[model samples]
Target: MTRRVLRTLLPAAALVWTAAVGPAAAAVPLPIDAPLCGPAELERLDGLQADLDAKAAAGEAGRAQYWYVDPRACRLSVAVLRGAEDAHTEGFVGAALAASALPAPTSLTEVDEPVDRRIARVPAPAQRGARAAGTLHGGSAIYSGTSGLVYECTSGLNNYRPGTTTTAGHCADAATTWYDARGNRIGAVTDWRYPGTDWAVITPVAGWSLPNDVLGSTVPVARFGKASLGEAVCGRGATSGTRCGSVTAVNVTVNYPDGLVKGLVRSSQSGGEGDSGGPVYDGGTGLGLISGGASSGSPTFFQPLTF
Candidate 1:
């Protein structure tokens, strides 16, 4: 029954988040032309981090947390309940949790924060903008290049050939072209499979060298086991960031805008735009990529990494 459902549904939903509403294509490496953040922006992010630390210190024990970004301000942020006892530590670690099925985000919006209470507001990008780099939504340091049209989320690692790193497929679909901050072509999409599988491996037209800590310090890619229903899993992505959720269903089939792919795992966690190709794993084992999810619901689907 589970296999039957998954075989039918996972592919159509591939471009759900970004395709539903978002920006355009790839560009240069992030952080290069990225303007240094000002004191006010730094303070705001610091406070958010402090608040998360406070919660963790207060013993709020859960693998979930909050994520916020103001594309207008070019600010990306995350808040995790402190002392998160997980062995995974690639930045964007906090985004792995905190997706709520409540009031859903319909469009790509920034988060704003009030002086009091933990209020997150989305900031509008300034007229003169640059790239935004930070830990990935899947717990690694990541740099994103801005193409005026879209934000290209780039990672410094790849699972296919260890040591090969590049950006997400969503970025490719959105980008007209890609380059290094130095204004050099890095690579274009040699191949990409969306709705079917979240993983898109790009063969750089030229050799590309990536930073080691792009997402977080080096954490080896994990291995996976056949998942069981109701299994607990931890995951991270370039866009939606990092999060932890349980397997809501196994072998569930989904329909994406494109063709279909199989071996899906579903979760109740929330993932959003930019997080499309993130990795979902069980502790030390890798599972899949962020396939697609209900923009306003709890069903987060992943295309198994193995497939």
Candidate 2:
């Protein structure tokens, strides 16, 4: 009887479910005409949905705040600012779904404000090791002073170049010089792209090299691209370490206080104040960097690499 129970349990335990959220995952970009709710409306939200998207792209003052499909809730959600609701946004969405003849599991969310998740963040209890580390790896703590916040952040992917790595473009904007957890001088910012697309390329000085490995893991990025729906992903931050969640939406536009940022990804994982520019990955493949999140719902938004 014991042997029989063990045999049954062993097979059940061994039956694991997995998806290769790597290069293949990137290949499958979110459909252009995806429904507002979930996968049920693929290729159907087109034509009539144009006005709705336009409103979402309107940015800070626009009636519609954001639009994305929630796979967990299996619906599309359009978030409007708490006090900024207009009938046109709702009517347009309804008309599009009606024309598509699909059961629209769609709803609108009201958020207090957009989450500006740049590396120039609010201060938190300082974590050790951010003083300096001559050898910086992905997800390692980085110290770069911003105007008001004495913030530390996690490093992003290291480029194929000899001594270069990437972080939040806003991070480069925060300070002229960057330091590592051990207080070692890391290097200088080479180029920065923020607001529109958030990324920065850093060229470390002599004696410092940006390694390919993540700080806490043996695996490093072999490739990078857009994240796919339902793909399992993880984000690494100086504050959060590593948090795993499913890629819930892509091709998302976030209306940040700085400006309207287009082309972001949303996940269920959570990060803290100093988590900006952290690495988001699937297996060994890089996915994105932490952008910001809402005050509620606790979603961690990331900036996907354009390739």
Write down the TM-score of every candidate: 0.45, 0.69
Cα distance off (Å), candidate 2, residue 270: 0.6
Q: Report the CA-based lDDT of candidate 1 relative to the real structure.
A: 0.41
Candidate 2 residues lying further than 4 Å off, grouped into runs, are 1-64, 69-76, 83-106, 111-114, 118-133, 146-149, 160-162
RMSD of 2: 12.1
Q: How big is the positional error of residue 243 in model 1, measured in Å on the Cα after superposition?
A: 1.0
- Alpha-carbon deviation at 108 in model 1, angstroms: 30
Error of 1 at 143 (Å): 8.7
Model 1 per-residue lDDT at 57 = 38
Candidate 2 residue lDDT tens string, 137-166 = 888778774233566766888873446877
What is the Cα-based TM-score of model 1? 0.45
> Residue 80 lDDT in model 1?
28
For model 1, give the 10-residue run with minimal summed lDDT: 111-120
The lDDT leader among the candidates is 2
Model 1 ranges with Cα > 4 A deviation: 1-146, 151-157, 166-186, 204-219, 222-226, 257-261
